[model samples]
Target: MFFRFACLLLSMLLFSGVSRAEDPVREAQAVIANQLSAFASDDAETAYSFASPNIRSIYRSETQFLDMVRKNYPPVYKLGNYAFGRSKLVGGGELVLQEVLISGEEGQDWTAVYEMRLMDDGSYKVNGVRMKRNTTSEGI
Candidate 1:
């Protein structure tokens, strides 16, 4: 049993390291997905932790940040499903712009463009999001 536990621990450590080595686009998308999951459970602190320093500076507190998201971004705050759309690196690879096509809880389609900035600690954080109502019949 001890040998089996050792092997499992090693595998977990290796997998965790490999996950962080993913490309910038995937990394940014992962951060966004994590934040959305946090919102689904109303985990304000976890959701706010994914925000960039600039955003955190403005919001100041987790409650305030979560409140803003709930008020201004209903689709993201309560999503049914989401798919990754277009993605590109900007600012000389320091930033990733990713488009997420979301189906809201109320069945409305929306597009959320997220700007993710690479922080000094080598993690990407959500800098901002620009959301627009999908006027077309396209589905994600």
Candidate 2:
């Protein structure tokens, strides 16, 4: 009876760890959704808040980052009807890979693959995003 009890306790511990790991993915999804909503509303300050510190540092200022986004990823600024698909844990829960699809103005569609990293701050942030322009390409 003691052995069975010990086994059950161990199982519970393992399950708890798995549940903790899953939190990162959920946090990442929320962050991404918030950013998308801000973009749709043209609230650059709100959208910039969702970016990782590393990203913010790279851009130096929120205004600069907003300008870059507006100039380079204009379609993203007008994003709508976004959806996340095919999320997978990468590197033992240290990272997550997610496929994002968004519709733009005038029936335009965009697809991107995002790599999100779990930061030490207990928040998940997008580390990289690769926009897929061609659907016919099999390999990159």
Candidate 3:
């Protein structure tokens, strides 16, 4: 029941396109999807643009950032499938927690907790992501 409610709330946030103009869930999804799509298409520039300012600073260059993602987040770069799930608002909506179900190249199952941050442009960017491999009897 809780999962259903959370999914519904996230769905509302995702489709409403700036719900109340205060919630940034839609922007978060857009940025994440855009970056991932860029990765799939090998478009480093577009993917780097979706990252938060802090991430941009850390990576310092598009090539550097793209290499890091290709090396560290292979699943996100080459996913078999993915879907957004529950989301939680934090820091009065400045930050958000988004759950993602991801299947990797070899069909490895993972749950990604995406940390989203609202930017000055009235949009959201991906701040960080932590992935956990899901262990289940029924393999993905």
Candidate 4:
């Protein structure tokens, strides 16, 4: 029947559209991994390539960004180990929030939360990073 054929066509179109939706979390993870690898190898240019346009605009050049990272986020530059914890899509998939744990040579441990934006190119990149120091209270 024509009705049956039309219904099947519609179902297929809907499924295809849903499947085309981008997975922001996965994209963000890949970007983060690329950046981390660059940092580990001291490849500033490669690491800067992973930065979002907004970040690149703020820093102007890869060298400047590298200097800022080395001067400000020393621990991240010296990071020895890291683990990606949890990632969630928020605001109806417009934003991705992820948490990462990092350890450095000085026995320093840090937890960082990243807010990523879904770019028009179907990729995700970090827009902001909020770091927290992991510590315990010295109680009496």
Query: Whose lDDT is greatest here?
Result: 1
All models: lDDT? 0.89, 0.73, 0.81, 0.77
lDDT of model 2 at position 81:
70
Worst 10 residues of 1 by lDDT: 131-140
The sequence of per-residue lDDT tens digits that candidate 1 reaches over residues 41-119 is: 9999999999999999999999999999999999999888898888888765599988898988767888898999999
Better of 3 and 4 by TM-score: 3
* Model 4: per-residue Cα lDDT at residue 47: 85
lDDT minimum window of 10 residues, candidate 4: 131-140
**Tens digit per residue, CA lDDT, model 4, 1-140:** 99999999999998976765556666687888788788878898898887788898899888898888888776677787888878878876778887777886678887777778887876677677777777322211
Candidate 2 per-residue lDDT, tens place, 1-140, comes to 99999999999999998787667667677878887788777787887877777788788777887787778776666676777766778676678777777676677777766777777866777676777652322322
Question: Which portions of model 4 miss their true places by more than 4 Å?
Answer: 1-22, 135-140
What candidate 3 gets wrong by more than 4 Å, as runs, is 1-20, 135-140
- Candidate 1, residue 48: the lDDT equals 98
Residue-level error in angstroms, candidate 4, position 81: 1.2
Give the better candidate number (1 or 2) by TM-score. 1
- Superposed by TM-score, candidate 4 places the C-alpha of residue 90 at a distance from the truth, in angstroms, of 1.7
Best by TM-score: 1
TM-score leaderboard ranking: 1, 3, 4, 2
Q: After TM-score superposition, what is the CA distance of residue 6 in candidate 4 from its true location, in Å?
A: 21
